[model samples]
Target: ELAPRGYIAEGWLNAVRTREDAYPTGLAMPAANIAIPHTDPGFVAKPYIAVVKPAAPVTFNAMAGMGAPVPAQIVINLGIAEPGGQVEALQALMNIFMDTDAAADVLGQTTPQGMVDAIRRHF
Candidate 1:
């Protein structure tokens, strides 16, 4: 979705996959398990946050759990254009995830637009 809008480079998906393999981003939140996958800024054409809720849970490695598996129902892909921005964005996302009400609000949305709206409302 982001590529057509010029938010990322041609190999951004591959790059993010490779990076996720090396440094996992899955977090086990109170409301839901989630993954925040991203790559280096070079692959990003513009900063964008892509939120996805798969039809079924997707397995991801826990960020700080040394390869522990996390079945993530929500995935937030971050396309950040600057290194500093990545940290800031992650911090903000963490805040939301840590808030049960906020996380539940985001997870409660059924549609893409509704999800985006929920995120924006909490963010």
Candidate 2:
């Protein structure tokens, strides 16, 4: 969807799917399980962050190892301009990720507006 909207490059979605196969994105937080799926910055048309919540939990291999699987309730997709931007964005994300209480509040967001509001508050 974002690809068509020019939010990301032509192969961005496929790139992320492929990269995720080799390097999983699952994060097992105390408050809620989350996944950060991102691809190379070259595939980004513009910098953006997208939040998604699945109707049912999805299992993804944990960042720790192949043997560990994390059930993700929410997924955060990041499209950063480059490596430097990726680092900066990730550092900001770490602040939210490390705090289970804050992360839970983000996960609790139901509507799109609510999610947008939550991100605004966090960032």
Error of 1 at 37 (Å): 0.3
Encode model 2's per-residue lDDT on 40-95: one tens digit a residue. 98999888898888998888888747457988888888898777676677667767
Instruction: Using lDDT, give the best candidate's number.
Output: 1
TM-score of each: 0.93, 0.88
Measured on C-alpha atoms, candidate 1 has an lDDT of 0.89
lDDT of 1 by residue, 36-59 (tens): 999999999988999999999899
In model 1, what is the error at residue 57, expressed in angstroms?
1.0
lDDT of 2: 0.81
Give candidate 2 regions above 4 Å deviation.
64-67
State candidate 1's TM-score: 0.93
Give, for candidate 1, the lowest lDDT window spanning 10 residues. Answer: 64-73
Q: Which ten residues in a row have the lowest lDDT in candidate 2?
A: 86-95
